[model samples]
Target: MCCAHKNENRGAFIVLEGTDRSGKTLQCQKIYDYLISIGRKCIKTEFPNRSTDVGKLLDGYLRKTIKLAPEVSHLLFTANRWELNDYIEKNLQNGVDVVCDRYSFSGIAYSSGAINLDYEWCKSKEQGLVSPDLVIFLDINLSLSSSRSGFGDEIYENIKDQNNVYEVYQSFSNYSFWNNIDASQDPDVSLKNC
Candidate 1:
């Protein structure tokens, strides 16, 4: 519902948000591929990019190699998104849609889920970052989520944590720009909704 002002000619800034193993990556890739096929200039990226220094730090934390306070970890995730704000803006300005696998919403939901960190606090940390023109939430239950191929490889992998995260994601259902797709369905059917 928080729509930023942009020129009509600019490409859309799209975000794909969901809990762990919700098929966000696969669906995002499908959206990107379709956009390309239709001749839309576009680029796809994910949060905690894992290529930059902060991202590497995040990766380390995800892999359980380093330990930090929950609040600190959450801030790092928000910072990772801030790190890409300019790039997102640039792509949109140049008429290239920026499709993100995860954005500040995930940082807020996943980090605050079952934690002392407040949703408002986590949201405040990402205030200045670019907001998406469209947010597609891939809705799938935690059981099916854990059944995914790479379910437990990183942090926030368990059913309990994912359940809390899923609850937070549900809170965004009322947002005007948000759209929920049953990710448990066939990929082609899900893509059709996209």
Candidate 2:
């Protein structure tokens, strides 16, 4: 079994993680819609939520309007997620499935991959958070992801950083809860795999 800590009475916590433009958002929506249509309680959410106070800083950083040291930026990202912990946990406990577009995995992979931060330290910050019941990683090729529309609009959207992040994500494939889906496939096919 996966190392995820789950309560049998709680709804599943599912996370979809991948590089920018790797269709995480889309798949999240698809999964949520499917669940809802089938009479399941589900909500779709994304990390670096860009709505909270910390998320506002992260949004500014991502939009190139502000600059921060790599470590600080990474912490800000983690804090942003922390801001949502209560909401996520409460929903799960209420039997509402949570479909998150990204989570701690992205934070660690992006920070470690993009700026060469210590992977262990990056992982360490994620302690004491709700673990996903299932993590679906959309595995898209860097070249194809880079060529997608609006690819270079944000940080870590380039090929080199993405390649690094992809490698880091690959390293997590051995975990039983982690599912890797080929992002290059048709949306229907990919959704089916998910």
lDDT scores in order: 0.87, 0.90
**TM-score, every prediction:** 0.96, 0.96
Estimate, for each residue in 18-99, the C-alpha lDDT of model 1 and write its tens digit: 8888888888899999899999999999997999889999999998889979998998888888888999988898889988
Judged by whole-model lDDT over C-alpha atoms, candidate 1 comes out at 0.87
Which residue pairs collide, candidate 1? none
The top-ranked prediction according to lDDT is: 2
Clashes of each: 0, 0
Q: Which parts of model 2 are misplaced by more than 4 Å?
A: 1-6
lDDT, model 2, position 159:
85
Candidate 1 segments exceeding 4 Å error: none
Report the lDDT tens digits of candidate 2 across residue range 5-27.
Answer: 55677888999999889999889
User: What TM-score does candidate 2 get on C-alpha atoms?
Assistant: 0.96
